[model samples]
Target: MKALFIGGTGIISSAITRQLSETDGCELYLLNRGNRNESLPANVKVLQADINDESQVAKLIEDLSFDVVADFIAFRPEQLERDYRLFHGKTKQFIFISSASAYQKPLSDYRVTESTPLANPYWEYSRNKIACEEYLIKQYREQGFPITIVRPSHTYDERSIPLGVHGSKGSWQVARRMLANKPVIIHGDGTSLWTMTHNRDFAKGFIGLMGNIHAIGEAVQITSDETVTWNQIYAAIADALGVKLQAVHVSSEFLAACSKEDYTGGLIGDKANSVVFDNAKLKRLVPDFVASTRFDQGVKQTVAHVLAHPECQTEDPEFDIWCDKVIDALQGAIASVKGR
Candidate 1:
């Protein structure tokens, strides 16, 4: 099989790229901005160009085509439209990476399947992804444009830990708070169920559908079947870091409302609600697909990787300060109401 990945060197797609380039019996080409110095296998061809510049990409890949072309970075309808124009007849499959967050917010059911109605108003990011998926499905139905949509939820690589209450600086800040024995936030008493998939495991199900004809015109969510509460998720990370779990509980809505960026979408829209995915569709399509990594196991690996690498220990003083303020204000509010 011949495959092409646009924006391949990301947290998720990098795993797929490595897997394909190493042992899929497939010729792989990774097109990216050439900014990162990730050590990829030499056999994998790198297309160095800005994909946003259509003319530049066209001139670069003059006559190239593939059995599968997956775009990992496209988040909007316009981007998908560009892909429809570029790879319409050039590939056997065009996979659009969508988000499980695009699933209906305040879900009607805790269980989500591929057919779960897509609607997310809290997060513009999720809405944009919903729009993109809609556009692709439209193209598939009207023009027979071989499209496959893969929705991923909270998938993590070795580089970062997946956290629902992370600050603007990303998961690293949460890790730092853990190491420092500071009070890390876990939204809404830490009881919402969420699933996190390891990148390598996610790659297996994803790669299985790369050249699959049955997957065309289909939407499938690839995620771990194992579900954990927000409390357990934090405890696993604390366990991995060999530290006492110091979690401060806060409402997701309050967390979002307090922040200038208003993470209501990521927090309230997505992670605040419990979600258990039915991967029966994924399994029916790819019989061998199994998310083998347990949270207790996967999180330890992530924490170890980040701890050993000093470069990954980047700090977020601003977020740290904000967390302290939120904690203090909550404490003060409680005390003042009692006339303390």
Candidate 2:
């Protein structure tokens, strides 16, 4: 099988690339901007080109035909349009990486299946993804473009410990707070249920969909069945670091209004709500798909990896100050109400 991955080295797609490279008779080509220094499998080749430059992309893959072409970075319909023009007849399958956050916000149902209606009025990012899906479905219906949509929710790898809030410094900052026993901010009272999938486990279901005919014109969310609360997730991380959990629960609405713009989309619009994914569709399609990594186990590995590496401990003084400000504001509000 000949496969090409556009923007392969990401939180989710990196695992898929690793899997594809090791698969028997699978020839994988990574199309990226030659930036990140990920040690990919030796057999897997690199096709260096900027996907945004239509001419460059065309020239790069002009002579090659692939059995599967999975794009991991395309977020808009225009990019999908470019993909349709480029790989319409060149690839057997074109997989688009969609987001589970694309599902309806303030959802009508907490359980989301592939059939769940795609709508997110609160976030333009999800709205754009919804538009992209619509464009691909149109292409599939009208032009016979073979397309499959795979949605992933809160998927983490060895490099990251997935969390509800990271301030502005990213996951390492939250991990730092945990290590220092400082109160880590958790949005929405820390009770909202969330699903976090290890990228290694996510690879199993996604690789099964490669060159899979049943996946054509279908949308499937590949995630672990394991569900945990934001509080539990934070505790898991804290436990991994051998520290006590110090969590400060804050309102998601307040976080959105006061924090960065990403809070509006990445938090209130998506992670704020509890989501239970019905991965029965993925299971039915790929019987071998299993997400075996428990949060406690995966989180331990992530924390260990970050601690062992000096580069992963990213610092953000501004974000640290922001967190303190938010906590202070919450405390001030409480004191005023109590007449203290």
Candidate 3:
């Protein structure tokens, strides 16, 4: 099978790229601007063109076609439009990496499946993803576009630890605080259920859908069955870092009001709410798919990788200061209430 991945070097797609590159009789091509070409496997071919530049990409891949083309970076419907223009009838299968967050916000039910209504008013990112899914589904229905929608929920890799609440830079600041014994903020009492899947595990199920005729025109969510609370997630990170969890619980609304970043979207729209994915559809489609990495094991590996690689530990002093400020204000509020 021949597969082409657009923007392949990312947290989720990177694992898929690695999986396909190693599979027997599989030919893989990565279409990107050649930024992290060195990180890819040796067998994977490189198409050195920006996916946004339609003409340049068209010229580059004029004579080539693939069994699969997966786009990881396309966030908006316009991007999907560009993909349709570029790869219409060019590939056997087109996989859109949609987010599970595109599922209904403040869901009527805690369990999320592909059938979950697409609605997220708080985050434009999720709304755009929802739109992209709708467009691709329409294309599949109207034009016989061989499209497969795979929604991933909070998938993590070795590069970064997954967390519900964190600053713009990344989750490194929170991990740093854990190591320093400083209080880290967890939104909403830290008991909300969240599922975190390792990218490697996500790769297994995604690969199953590559040339799968059954998967075309279907939307499937692939996530781990393991559900852990936000508290357990932070505790795992702190355990991995060999530090005690000094966590300060704060309201999601307060955190949104305090931060300059789009916490309203990142938190309320997506991570703040409890989500437990029903991977029954994914299992039915990919009979062999299983998410083997537990949260503790995955996060432990992630924390160790970040500790070993100083480059990954890029400190965010501004976020750190902001965390301290939030913690201090919360403490002051407690003091004032006690005085009253």
Candidate 4:
């Protein structure tokens, strides 16, 4: 299989890159700015060009055609428009990495399938993804663009731990608080269920879709069937850190009001809601694909990787301070009510 991945070295795409590179007959090519090409496999060809600059990217891949082209960085519909121009007839399959968050906000049902409605008014990111999906589907239906939409939900790798409530920098701060024995904030009583897929496991399902005739013209969401509460997710982090869980539950509304971050969208619109994805569609398309990583096991590997790698241990003091403030204010409110 000859495949090209745009913006390949990310939390999700990096794993795919690695897996495909090691495959017996896979010819993998990566197109990006080439800043994060340090640890990629030597067999992989690197095309160093910014995808935003269409002319530059066009010239770079003028003579090269791929069996599959997956775009990991396209967030807007205009970007999809550019991709259509660049790879209209050049590839047999075009996979757009959409988000499962594109599923309806406050979903009518907790279970999600490929047929789930694409509507997310609460998050501009999800809404934009929906638009991108719409554009690609139109292209496929009207002009046979050969597009396959793959939606990933809360995928994590060894580089970063996944969490419900965290600041802009990422979930490292939340893990750091766990290590330091500081209280970590969990939104919406921590009982709302969520699913986190290990990126390595996500890679298996994604690779199955590449150059797959069945996946073309279809939107499939690839996620683990395992669903755990936000509390259980955080507890796994604490267990990985070898510390007692010091969790402070806060209302999603209050957290959104207190923080400058997009808690309203990231929390209420997405994470605060209980979501269990039905992977029957993925299974029918890719019979061998199964997400084998449990939350506890994956979180342990992630926490261990973060601890061993200094680069992943980025300290977000500002977010840490903000967490303290949120926890303190909640405590004060509770105390005041008790005194009254």
- For model 4, the superposed segments whose C-alpha errors exceed 4 Å read none
Give Cα-based local distance difference scores for all models: 0.90, 0.89, 0.92, 0.92
Give all TM-scores, in the order shown.
0.98, 0.98, 0.99, 0.98
- Which window of ten consecutive residues has the lowest lDDT sum in model 4? 164-173
lDDT of 1 by residue, 88-145 (tens): 8889999999999999987999999988889988999999999998899899999989
| Ranking of models by lDDT | 4, 3, 1, 2
Q: Give the TM-score of candidate 2.
A: 0.98
Q: How close is candidate 4 to the true structure, as a TM-score?
A: 0.98
Candidate 3 residue spans exceeding 4 A from truth: none
Compared with the true structure, what per-residue lDDT tens digits does model 2 show for residues 139-250? Answer: 9999889999999898999886788887666788888877888888999888898999999999999999998989998999999999899989988889999999988999
> Distance (Å) between predicted and true CA of 322, model 1?
0.3
Quality of model 4 by C-alpha lDDT: 0.92
Q: Taking the tens digit of each residue's C-alpha lDDT, what string does model 3 give over 157-211?
A: 9999888877778889888888788999999999999999999999999999999
